[model samples]
Target: MGFQEFLGNERIVTALRGALRTKRVPHALLFTGARGVGKFTLARMFAQAANCERLPDDFCGECATCQRISQLADPQTLLEQGLAERGESADAATVERVPLILQSHPDVWALVPDPVRLKSPVARPMLRVGQLRAVQRAAYFQPMGRRRVFILDGAETMRWDVANVFLKILEEPPGSATLILTAPSPYALLPTIVSRCLQFHFAPLPQAAVEKILKEKTDRKPTEIKLAAQLAEGSPGLAIEMDVEAAAQRRRSALRILERAAQGHGFAQLFSDTSALAKDRDSSFEHQIGVFYGLLTDLLELTSKVKEPVLRNAPLAKELESLAKSVDSAWVLRAIAGFDELYVGARRNLNRQLGLDALAASLAPAPSRASVTHS
Candidate 1:
């Protein structure tokens, strides 16, 4: 996709376009922002624009070069060309897609870590030294295009050794190569790495942009779209990815728990809901903890008067307002702290029902020692 498809970040787009127009693109760039803010998407677009034969400001989406960069032009021909460039003989079926199959484009290479597994004790995938070494080896080659672009998605996932290797490349990069890195924040990487690259900070999209994307991209109800956009915290990718119905149901269940906890009533429904959530193996317990935290968030937002008029749980605005009136900010703050402790405890595979009960109990005026047990 071209830069036209990217919403928000017009300033960044303009600057990058100017650089391209001047034929002065930097050798290394770091696109830093929150998750799903289109850092990787923009990097792909930049690669397309740098290599495209017929575009100045934007890549013609249908051009042979643009389509190849996008991994959609001609898989078999691209595979053959990539194999020939690398001096390898491989069948087309053996080839993977872009980012994974870095050889798909003669002037493009991608380094992306595997999916992070937060639930398990296993570590998140990282950009290893070997991967960096491969890129280093490929750097000296003459590119088929006038410029070569190496896109590194999740640049923060690199370990110290890997990062050092990447630093060396950035220090003396190939004259024809442009390196692009995407991360949640450059602070996660070595200062040396951050120092070497030109930084572009990508902010979250506005609610209007997110709503527009949700409307254009999905068939979710308008109410659901609005709520998802609010919950997305300005990330349009998150807005579209949200399971609206599931989130609504989760919020309702969390509200019930809050009601029971505040009133010091029996937590029968709380236990029942938590048990069901635990049974849904596809849904993480962390999500349930987040829902629990959302109740306190709603209370604090509504009472503080500083938050936007649109609440995450607007459907339960009356209930939240009623709850807000019953307690002062001190109690809400303590309850929020208690839920935060429970949320941290969730990472340790704590008993889901027990954690919910403790969270519910903590909402009372006098929290028991059990409330802090998981903390």
Candidate 2:
């Protein structure tokens, strides 16, 4: 993708273009932002622009060098040649194929964690020292072209030893090479690693921008696009993944829970509502809690207004209106507060069921006292 096709982050784009125009591109650059916000895409364009044989400023996308870099063909060609040299058969060659190459430049070396180390599973996968060493070895080599670029996609995943191994190369990068690192945030990386690079902060796209990307990239319906754009918190990637039906279902479930509580049904119905959130060790439990929190926030917003409020869960407008009519803002506020506790507790790794029970208890209306007659 050229800079022309890339959307949003105008300031970052301008700065990068300025670097290219001046022939003062940094040897090491860090692109940090939320996932799916085009950091990796922009990095690829920058690399292609830097090494383009014909035009370095605007990047002639048709050149052999640009095509190879954009396709990440160097490593693939190297692997295929090595296989051919060993006289591997077709069947074996199929098995030996690299799984993760979406694309890269021939002059652009892409580094990621070795899958063997990642097979065991972890919250964060470790980028092994071997990968860094390979990069280090390649660092000293003369480029096959005018400029060489190394792209580390999940730079934050580098283990302590792995990060340490690359520190020297990062500080004083070798011949005609530019290194680019992409991560969710610079804070996720080591201070030493962060300090060595020229950092570009990628901001989340605005709702309209996210919606535009969704419209262009997917066949999602208008309503789904609208709801997802509102719910995505400015991440186009998240917006594309959001399912409108599922979110509406959660909204309905939340309204049902509120209705049961207001009817003085106590913990039974609300407990059932949160049955999916009983796990202390699972992240899904946290997500379920968040869904409930979104519901309460919707209720609070709906009830505060005499009419319907603008809703991400717009499909649940009728149910929201009904709930708003029945419950006062004070009651809805209390329910919202209850969910706040559950959300906080879930994050802190407190007992999920206990938190849900406490939340339900707080929201359940006080028991009615029978009148005592004096004879």
Candidate 3:
């Protein structure tokens, strides 16, 4: 797919397209963004475009090369071709000298993740050291095509030992090869690895950008698109993954807890509910955080756009107004700080329920003042 097919991210599209046009594709690139934000998808398209014969900013998707790439048949053939050489006695020594992976030719071999160490981890799949080794092994051989591209999705999942494994290769990668890695965030990656590659940061998509693509790509209803776009917070990929029914359930749950946080004095109930909520893998702790962020974004939007007293959440908006009467900007800042810390912990494999419970407790005012009032 051409970058033009990608909605939003005009800056990224422009830069990458320009690079392709100039034939100045970087050997290594780091794309950092949230999962389901189209990072992996984009990286694949880039790999295809680099190998494509049609020279332009956009891909002529009708070409033989384009068709093969679209079908992901090119790399497989390359792998198969390399394998034939190694087994054939025609040139056994040269073939044997080639890396085992290259012995079959360059193909996408996602690194095996380290055995799961954390008890409750958000990352189900990770990239392993074995995968990084292949990058080096593949480097000795020349590309069958004009350019060879290796797409590594979930680069941040590289365990600590394997994390810096790519640094040396990235620093001086083969001219004919390109390594494209995508990750939710680069902060967790070793700085040495990060600094060596050309970095591309993907910002969350706007609501309109997401909706347009949904309309273009799928047969979703208008309302479904609206709600999904609203909930995805700018990630079109995740928006597509979103189940309308599940999203509605999340809203219901969030509203329920939000009301509890607003009016209920039983701190124990809030803690218990959130604690239980965090343990739910089906409804991921991250998804719940998205729900919370969505609510806050809605409230902020409402407060700024509307003339009427905050009407969205009667209880919570009312509490917000009351707090606004006395609370300085610092209180809101502190709440964000608490939530941010929880978000950090959640990413670092902290217990979701504990992180959220602590966040709710921190966001809630001390019990004496925040206690439920009787009419």
Candidate 4:
């Protein structure tokens, strides 16, 4: 699609178009923002604009070159497509074994995190040195198009050694190539790397903007669309990709825990509820933790008496408001902090039950003065 098709981030679009108009495209670009804002989409469009045969400063989006570049897919999609082509099941074992770099056009490379060590389910996916080395070698060649574009998705996944390899490329970039790196924030990357590239920060889209985009892109129910839009926290990409039913379920489960804790439930009851929630494999534990965090944030907002506070779980606003009254701002703030730690721990494959237990314990309200005095 052309740049006009990309919604939100008008400033970034203008800057990219200006770069094209002046024919002064930087050799490297760093797009920093939260996940699913539009960094990767913009990167793809920029690559097309740089190489589109039909336009000098913009993409027609119909030319052979532009169409080919648009075929780029994320790693999971690429892997699934490959497996489907082979008539093989995309089982966990099979998925863990594949290392992927999706290239739809010879001149366009889309790099994502692959398992650093193959055949190991626990091995974190990263942009390893080997992948950067391949890009390094490819960078020296003349491209079939005007520019060879490399889009490094999730660039923060690179460890120091791998980042060092990429640093060399940035230090001496090829004349005919442009490198694009996308990360959640610039601080997540190396200072040296951040200093080398032209940086752009992508802001989250407004909820209305996100809702409009969701209507355009997805066929989910209007209610689901509205909920997804609210829960996405301004990322249209996230709203588009979110599993609405699963999100709702997660929110319900998270709210149950909050309710129990607010009512000063005992450890056994809290642990039992947490165990049931953790056992549901419908969604990732990390995602479950994220939902809990969102609920906690909403509770914090309600407890703090924010004027017209926008909530991620708007459907439960009344319930959250009622719950907010049962707890003080101090406990909600502390619970939010606990969930932040739990979210990070979830990413590290922490024991879900144990972590949830600890979180529930932390969320336990202090004893009432009457009870303490009676005891």
Candidate 4's residue-wise lDDT over 190-308, tens digit each? Answer: 89999999999998788889999999988889988888988787789888889877777778878988998877755567788899878886665655766787788898888888999
- Looking at model 1, residue 66 earns an lDDT score of 86
Q: How much lDDT does each candidate structure score?
A: 0.72, 0.68, 0.64, 0.80
Worst 10-residue lDDT window, candidate 2? 366-375
Off by over 4 Å in 1: 72-99, 115-123, 219-224, 249-304, 307-375
Tens digit of lDDT per residue, candidate 1, span 166-196? 8788888888889999887776678999998
TM-score of 1: 0.67
Clashes of each: 0, 6, 4, 0
Q: Which portions of model 3 show Cα errors greater than 4 Å?
A: 72-123, 255-259, 262-264, 297-329, 367-375
Reference-based TM-score, model 2: 0.63
lDDT of 3 by residue, 1-375 (tens): 466677777788788878888989888888998767777667767766766668566666677666666654233454455446445342323422443332122333322232222233333546645557767777656776667777776677676676666777886788888888777677757888888778998988877898997888779999888877776778888888788777767666775565565553567777777766776667756567666665554455454544664332333455445534443444445555766787778667877766776666666656644553433
Kindly list the per-residue Cα lDDT of model 2 for residues 1-375, writing each as its tens digit. Answer: 467877889888888889888878788999998666777778878878888888767677788878877665234454444335434333322322432222354567776543332223333334556567667777777877666777788787776565888898987778588888988777668899999999989887777898899999889888888887776656686667676666556556666777877666645556776665474232345446555655666777877773646554456667767766777789878877777677556545577777877776666666621221223
Clashing pairs in 2: 68-106, 69-104, 69-105, 69-106, 71-104, 72-104
Better of 2 and 3 by TM-score: 3
Q: What is the TM-score of each candidate against the true structure?
A: 0.67, 0.63, 0.75, 0.81
Q: Candidate order by lDDT, highest to lowest?
A: 4, 1, 2, 3
